[model samples]
Target: MTSAPLRWPDAADPVIRGDLTVAVAYVTPAGGAVVTSVSPLGLGERENGLVGFTTSLGFPKKLERILRNPDVALAYHTREHGFAASDSYVLAQGAASVDLRPSPERLAELMRASGPFLGEVKRGPLWDWLLREYHQERVFVDVELKRVAVWENLAARGAKAVTGAAWPHHPAEQEAPRNGTGPRVELAAVARQIHRLPHRLLAYRGADGLPVIVPVKVTSHDEAGLHLDLPAGLLPPGGRRAGFLAHGFQPQCVGLGMRTLTGWLTVTEKDAIYAPHTSKGLAAPPYRTLLTVSNGLLAKYGVWRAQRDGTSARLQALAARRPTD
Candidate 1:
């Protein structure tokens, strides 16, 4: 059967054409959801409703997983005030496969186009050596979409909104026509929504090498990592992996998008510092919205007797006073 076409605002196409970074998520052999960034130029929409992108053959982890299981998701969003908004995000659920052989010219193009988005790039001998290696190894990944979900706040403007189709849609997918006229939500606004709604799905790999998604509550936020108070039953039998998926959605904004964070998830017995190698020092803690600890999370987990009393002042005060690295 033919695939469904991905629809977006024609005007918004320029935003994607402009220099922007996109996030791609794939399942690990063990079943955990891993998310990482790629250059927007690599993503192209085909006439047959397929979205294609290029990656490094050297990046074997993602490639092997895609070969084994074709299910995947691609996401893009605009950052306003350094936070991602629920309404500003777009998610594509599709199947993926490798296409085209690795070529030096394509590798060079990727290296050149990606340099601007990278943080603190060093032009030293090591950097040049890595570039040489990358040119030797790169390949293309093609994703064919079955469904697309987006968030735009139309009700806020006194218009009726369309409900998005359920994810992993059936082959005979049916969805609302694209209007493409939604206000952009900044990253800060999305961060606020996530903070207010701390109930998130945490994805990880299990001991059997299958993926596992569990419901977790945010305990505290620190530079170290997210402190989660989860049911002991949810811990994976295998040791931790470098990738995790944290996702949440707002019921009030049905047509608006969902929020997802893909990064290394580390669990700690006591609230501790985020691992040194992880995160690569993007933003430090003591964050106002994104980095700030969520009292709602504390209340949900009943931290310090909060569940019984419905008050988290003690934990809230402690989180506010704690020093961040």
Candidate 2:
């Protein structure tokens, strides 16, 4: 007999329906969790505990990474400019299944569903050609949440967790391999880069095997690492590897700047310290035209790089399960 589909709490609908973007964290092959942002356009019918976001096929590394490890988390920590009036933060942890090549009909359905949140889609031959790679060449990832955590406020402190299915029993945690306890990028320098950005988030794998993302603030910094103030009752006492992401974006992803880091975090009654390991990011020109041009160039390069690395072939293979209709 088949099992029933998982379902999230009814209270989570606001976050599922209105949040502009979610901080999606996926685990890497080396057991590190990486955080990135994706808009939940249309959100794929929030029935049966399913929620999703679209990703470009041009960036095949992202697809391959998810395929390698479906375990993921989405944090709906922002309510500004969205239909939801809820002041709370909702986080969903689940496994992902990718739709490699959705049919055109499915894409149109998404466009219409997205209109309320993203406004109208631009048409005409010029935009159509320019943004074909972005609009046409896309895939979807569906995450069926196993656990949903809610915080009374956006701070993500003083939170509670609700599970959709029976919780599993896992063994005592093993220390993840240290990839150079960081501050490798210079604590002061890294702080300078992300300090101005309003959104500060840290991602670490939870004991239940899901990557937990929490909003954080920089308390202070030393030559060794950056100290952070996180929500209460989160982050177990001890040391572990974590990822930090600071970003700012306007509507349509214009005028955006993001910085990410991998590091080691040690938590104690006194405080939690984050040591930055490696870092990379970019600042896009604020102008829409310039950003579009930049995206076109990057998409082109991404396709070539993906093809060269055989990621394109692997992605196509995943398309075999695409919808027939």
Q: By TM-score, who's the top model here?
A: 2
TM-score for every candidate vs. truth?
0.44, 0.89
Candidate 2 residues lying further than 4 Å off, grouped into runs, are 165-179, 317-325
- C-alpha lDDT of candidate 2 relative to the true structure: 0.76
Report lDDT per candidate.
Answer: 0.43, 0.76
Looking at model 2, which ten-residue stretch has the lowest summed lDDT? 165-174
The digit string of per-residue lDDT tens for model 2 on 1-325 reads: 9555666666678877888767888886666678877778638455577888988766576787787668899988887567788877888888888887789997877778777765566677876776667666668898877777777788976636565644334223337465556467777788899887778888877767778888999988997699899987676677777888888777656677788888778888899898888887868788877777676666666666777988778877755534331
- Superposed on all Cα atoms, the candidates' RMSDs to the truth, in angstroms, are 19.4, 3.3
Clashing pairs in 2: 183-276
Residue 2, model 2, lDDT: 57
Per-residue lDDT over 1-325 for candidate 1, one digit per residue giving the tens place of the 0 to 100 score: 9535655444324334442444566775533466554545535564455665666433445666666666666555433212233333444556676643557676666657554443222355754453443333345777766555444521111221222233321111112114321212333343354564333445443332333344456655544455555545335332243243332222211112235554344444443111112221122133222221231232224332442453334333333343341
- Output the worst ten-in-a-row residue range by lDDT, candidate 1: 272-281
